[model samples]
Target: MHSSNLRLEEPIRMASILEPSKPNFFPAMTKIVGTLGPKSRTVEIISGCLNAGMSVARFDFSWGDTEFHQETLDNLKKAIKSMKKLCAVMLDTVGPELQVVNKSEHPISLQADTMVVLTPDQDKEASSNLLPINFHGLSKAVKKGDTIFIGQYLFTGNETTSVWLEVDEVKGEDVVCMIKNSATLSGQLYTFHVSQIHIDLPTLTDKDKEVIRTWGVRNSIDILSLSYTRHAEDIRHARDYLSKLDGLDQTQIFAKIENIEGLKHFDEILQEADGVILSRGTLGIDLPSEKVFLFQKAAIYKCNVAGKPVVVTRVVDSMADNLRPTRAEATDVANAVLDGCDAILLGAETLRGFYPVESISTVGRICSEAEKVFNQDLYFKKTSKHVGEEISHLESIASSAVRAAIVVKASVIICFTSSGRAARLIAKYRPTMPILSVVIPQLKTNQLRWTFTGAFEVQYLLCFSSCSWLPLPS
Candidate 1:
């Protein structure tokens, strides 16, 4: 059903009221990314997520068809417009991912000294296997004495790496090798050359791009998230392709960083893309789990330094199906906020969950709370010199004043910021109250769309442009 068919209990802009004496309130701008799925497709559920502070709704093309996807997109637009919030939607495409073609249901269990035979014919599921190695490229990557790890079970042998072995006996279709640290049903496979295998598909799958284009024309989506991005070219290609569509150039493209290839070309990728997404779920499969956390942190730091928004996502909790998040899960949510990310994403938590509302509420609570302490230290500790000599003296004054207002709990901080530099400063401080920003030039409003404080109350003040508009040291 469309959002029009569903009723919202309250307006989407309604902010939660903490105790009157409480010192903290919501930050100036915090964007939440909620994935769309069975649980969240209903108008009521989608509204609940939005009410819980989701600024953007994402349609994961990996799961649904065109009809379902488009319908959901329409519903979100109706909901946001009805609520009078400038809503943003994102379309995420599933890229070329390696997979185990075919396998048996039985677990390929092995003990120490167990002799397993691998053959060419046994490797074939629906088609023919050209090589004898059970895995697609195990022989090429492994050596005669090299250690072989099969789902935490190790095997070493004197047999030549390339030598073909006949399946002397079979316990199941093939031995499940490299079972992850967690016993996930999504099996892992060893392969050579980890890169995007062109699936002869549109950068945005045919179905997905159509929906994105439609949403763009209607101003439904503000961001286009490219999943499985490998190089700078991917971002360029997406931007160019989308540029051909009407009213879509305003929609920014974000490259989802998941694989090693994307990380190796980080700088170039960041330049070509508007933002980045730390998609840890697929990343965990491609890399060791231990490394994912640090890699995510580095990505966040890079994005923040570059003034780009970054979204950290994955199974931050089991609440996708349960109401309450585990204690550890709560801490994980807090950590993402403390890391200074622009947004934290909820996948199954909001999409296919039993307690969608509760999950969003918990995430909102943790992020809003953590942002208070982290942002305060981050912004207050910086010196005026660190703000750069480039900022005119007056802009700096406006920025400092806004920060002071937040520190003192002013009902509203009215800022006369032209370049938006002043507002960004106020936003970085994680002010507890709303900021009523008065911009000198009307065009400057567009530039602040993604900035920390641009999201606050935007009002245009009458004035002509001037280089000396900001106070100078002289």
Candidate 2:
């Protein structure tokens, strides 16, 4: 019923046990974003994620050095080339984050009601007890009664540990603080503040800038995730920096809403950013633990209203250690899908977990089951805020195609998409029938599967794109 020249490659060797000729359409729409780390950094492991239903490969810049990340990027590229897969590399920024620096070789243990001085500059007065913070302008940002949490989570208006700080006084670089919670701390990087304080720091570190010019641009990094995004200005600054390297138009910027300010300024950040990452771990540090769930739900719904793709990260922290996820973790992922998240990101679970591949595997399954009862009709009703004044011909055609498929009870809706625009519009409408969108190799191989590049493909129509989709047995 189609052109003889059209040859669409439905991957016979895709990641799931389900038959590719007849995929479980439910699982393909929700993507699994796996991070590359010690457990899964090699070409083999990276390819494993691709075969395991993962659509995105996240590179956590928080811990690794430049050489290490560069090598990882090299391996990722090699894997993509070897397998001939199309996957997006998410380059995550380390910070504009604050860390506690001390002169003591051992970790410091502070008792409740104790006095601890946090200074932006080096503390010369008390060498043994002084806490030197990496973030500048802390003294100017905090007021009396503002709380500082060091690895402590506040849940349901109750403090988990007494190892927290309350701002007592501020003078220049010196911030006089009293320990409200007793926490033994060392040279652990990253800080959480109850105070909605903005700091003076470059959005991207100098090293981040250098890497952007190198691996970020040259290595074809698809998404640059800006961590600790506090304001819209942060994204603008990053865009300006990317522009300098001529990579502004080439890549998309994803803002990671980690703190209270980021949550408040998400609208502004969304205005400049291509998408959003609900950085839950850092959010736990900044807000009450119980509040994080509520915030995530709100953030996802709000992002949908704004038409920005939002990826929820660190949903399965316990799975990093445990082989199987806790019941709560499974529920958490389901809720994210129910909330209409574009994707869910696995951080430590895929990066340093015992079962990297299995984690990615499980997440896909959970999202699949969740999507079964996702209430697509109700979701559309709630999420649709505005419609275009003029319905474009493309929309008209896409809608008609879906309707026709449903009427005929067609197993699939195949669209010969050249630019992928028509295919996206069809999938966005979330037709009950499956979609098999045929596209040029301009779209990635991963784009072949799932509704959001899942469970869909048209015959590979060769074109003028740089990447080519070769013939694979259906």
Candidate 3:
């Protein structure tokens, strides 16, 4: 009777439609992605990292072999299970990187007036000690006396009457070739007047396709992080390959933006891509410093408009590898979160850094704090209307829908749009609830990767008739 009375003492309350399980807003938890490496390969260590804050772990395909990668992936899975967290594995590939094979043990230093030869020698690992400057086609594209940079260090002279070069005594393995002449580096095509033709690698290598297929068969990987993506064709081919994987034809693919071509074909890439990662390290070498910031900002705004989740990669400062991040670096991290990156990536910082725990914790703190400001501006903004429609009508509908989602305490607000215009407008209102925007086949859908700083749950439900709004997952 005492035990029965104790059971009967429990209060019973009727469920209410408007009742929300939790009042805290801002889309559940801020997604934190960390790259997996030697330092954090152990199951316990990886699990600790996941508990600390990492929500995603990227497996770099450019490094370890398949067997090693599989072992590591299994360890990560164990960690995820032990911690009881929903973690996603991202497959990062080594894209088409232009590298010079170097033969010299030490980096060759170039001093001004040092004549160097540009060769077609496959054996040569680095730039030659001396070479014949091809100025016959100087006026065609590259002129005399043009300063060319090799990797991040050396700068050689251009064509002049004498081809005399003051080379900076440089020393390094294969360095990336950079030309500076002031003729706007637009367009994807670059005419390098060299004796040897550049190597054109396949968008998806056989081994890469195999690993992607492995990802499908395992069903452990939730997201595919494609690196060095050059164009829409690359995304299309990747999608096709993924579709063939045992179980991954439908897995989410996040295109990593690290090259100029990828940026040029931003809209198309975004449309074809399921998500995006703004990898800054490789991108720094790919684009000029002045342009990188502006380009990143533009991508962010565009993604915001498209409602795709953008991941800001390479947040390296001293803090990433060191125990404490620099004040400026801390601010940089905060600014990206403010700029609307859905998540930020920690590469060597958490993988092989001295302070993986500290780095993860600090980044999480910065994201949490920055989100306050982001949320303030997000919820207050007005909705965008189509050209022919009444602005007031569109704005009113969007605001009302967002408010309804918020009051109902829905997990996600599902947006069904043919043109994706309604979703963008609704996103601008930025309800506290997550907005799962579903769009038909269109170019604008591709650009959404540049929009909101989160994930894009793309469902190819191409709306031929009706449009509706739904809530994101709780």
List clash counts for every candidate, in order: 3, 19, 50
- Whole-structure CA lDDT of model 2: 0.67
For each of the candidates, the C-alpha root-mean-square deviation to the true structure, in angstroms, is 12.4, 9.6, 14.3
C-alpha positional error of residue 118 in candidate 1 after TM-score superposition, expressed in Å = 13
- Best-performing candidate as measured by lDDT: 2
| Span of 10 residues, lowest total lDDT, candidate 2 | 459-468
Identify the runs in model 2 with alpha carbons over 4 angstroms from their true place: 1-27, 81-84, 102-105, 122-128, 152-163, 180-194, 246-248, 285-291, 382-385, 400-410, 432-437, 441-474
Considering TM-score, where higher is better, how would the candidates rank from best to worst? 2, 1, 3
Model 3, span 303-384: residue lDDT tens: 6555566788766546544677778777878777656666778876766676676678778776655554454333244124
Greater lDDT among 2 and 3 belongs to 2
How far residue 157's Cα lies from its native spot in candidate 3, in Å, is 24
How well does candidate 3 score on lDDT at residue 380?
44
Cand. 1 Cα-lDDT:
0.55
